[model samples]
Target: MSDIAKEIENAKRIIAEQKKRIKDAQKEAAKAESKLRDRQNYILGGALVKLAETDERAVRTIETLLKLVDRPSDRKAFEVFSRLPALSLPPQPAPDTGHE
Candidate 1:
C-alpha cells in the first residue's frame, strides 16, 4: 500500500482504540458513582434503623416506606419488620449501687 494509505489506516485504528478507551472510562466512572450511591443509601438506612429503635414515628415511617418495595425478592428481606418488636427498649435490670 502507498505511504498515505498506510497512514490513514493507522489513524483510523488509533481513533477506534481511543473511542473504546473513552467508553471503558465512562463505564468505570458510572460503576464508581453507583457504588458511592449504594454506600450512602446503606449509611442512611443504618441511621434510620437506629432512630426507629427509639422513635415511634421513625418506625411508622419505615413501615410505610417498606410498602414501596415492589420486587418480591426485595420484599422478602423486609419480612422481619412484620414481626418487629415495639419501638421502646426493654427495661434493664437496676445497677448495683452497693449503698443499700
Candidate 2:
C-alpha cells in the first residue's frame, strides 16, 4: 500500500473515533442534567414541605415572590406548590417522665 493511502486511512479512523467519543459525551451530559433536575425537584419539594409545616404565611410570601418573577420555571414551581395540600408538623412528644 502507498504511504499516503495509509495516512488517509489513519485520519479516517481518528475521525470516526472522535465522533463516537462526542456522541458518548453528549449522552452522558444529558443524563447528568436529568439527574440534576430530579435532585433539584426533590430539594425544592422538601423545602416547601418544611415551610408549610413551619409557617403557612411564609409559604404565601414565597408565592408572592414567585409571582413577581418572570421565569417560567418559577411559575411552574409555584403551580406545583399551590396544588399540594397544606402540611403540618406532627405534635412534639411530651417530656420524658421520671420512670424509664
| Best of the candidates, TM-score | 1
Tell how far residue 33 is off in model 1, in angstroms. 0.3
Off by over 4 Å in 1: 82-100
Q: 1-100 in candidate 2: lDDT tens per residue? A: 8999999999999999999999999999999999999999989867875775678786776556555755555444444443444422223445689887
Model 2 vs. true fold: TM: 0.53
What lDDT does candidate 1 reach at residue 65? 80
Q: What is the per-residue lDDT of model 1 for residues 1-100, given as tens digits with 9 covering 90 to 100?
A: 9999999999999999999999999999999999999999999988988888788888888777876776656765665553355432333345589997
lDDT (Cα atoms) of all candidates against the true structure:
0.77, 0.69
**Candidate 1 Cα deviation (angstroms), residue 35:** 0.5
RMSD of 1: 13.3
Model 2: clashing residue pairs? none
Cα error, candidate 2, residue 87 (Å):
7.6
